[model samples]
Target: MRAWLFSGLLVLLVGCATPAPDSLYQQLGGQTGITRIVEDMLLRAAADARIKQHFVEVDIVRVRDKLVEQLCELSGGPCIYSGDSMEESHTGLHISRSDFNALVELLQAAMDQQGVSVRAQNQLLAHLAPMRGEIIER
Candidate 1:
């Protein structure tokens, strides 16, 4: 009885202690701000030959707009995410962890270019951190 009671209390405490979702758009300035970051990030990603292969079959212009829209929605800005789910979008792409990491580095570089603060960066990253699991299939 005591052990069960202790477990219930622990669960309650954990639930109460959980923080709210970290919305990136609010942190890195706002709506227009995230668009600049996405633009820069895509540019950086395009410049790298290794990662560029992934975009060979893509429409770069559409990709950029979709990315901006997705980011805008993700950061709590007034926008909708029109892109497909991670599994659906990446299907047959064989994206590896290294490729994802490279893109992430480029993204961080772009965020830095826009002068996002450290705390905001971390919050943004944390918001995006879960996608890493869903995105890297290879």
Candidate 2:
């Protein structure tokens, strides 16, 4: 009986292992939802005087489109990114780690405002976290 019970428990555990969504964007309600979050995040980031200097030289509206496109593609959405490479686009402007972190914070806040669950937000962030290596100044 004990052996049978153990076998049953193992079977149950194995069957419960459903995979997470391959694309976080889909899990977060897709393009419309993602677009809303990105818009909110950019607005908040722009309002931040400490970090707005990064955008002083950029066309914020154009950058906004690129950012939305990039994030959508990275999250496994159907959109393709047509922007310059991170290294190329960010070159010559000595961007600091603090700047990146501030942007991340604003993104998280925007997600919160949009009613995304913490787990979904973290999962999306995890997908983006690796870009820090490429985005930060050496």
Model 2 TM-score is 0.77
| Model 1 Cα lDDT, one tens digit per residue, 28-134 | 66767787888888877778987988987898788888888877776666678888887787878889989998988998898889998878777777777888877
Tens-digit lDDT track of model 2 for 26-126: 66667787888888988897799768888777888788888888877777776789999888888777778999899999999999998988888998898
Candidate 1 pairs with clashing backbones: 25-75
Total backbone clashes of candidate 1, pairs 3 or more residues apart or in separate chains: 1
> Where's the lowest-lDDT run of ten residues in candidate 2?
14-23
Estimate the TM-score of every prediction: 0.77, 0.77
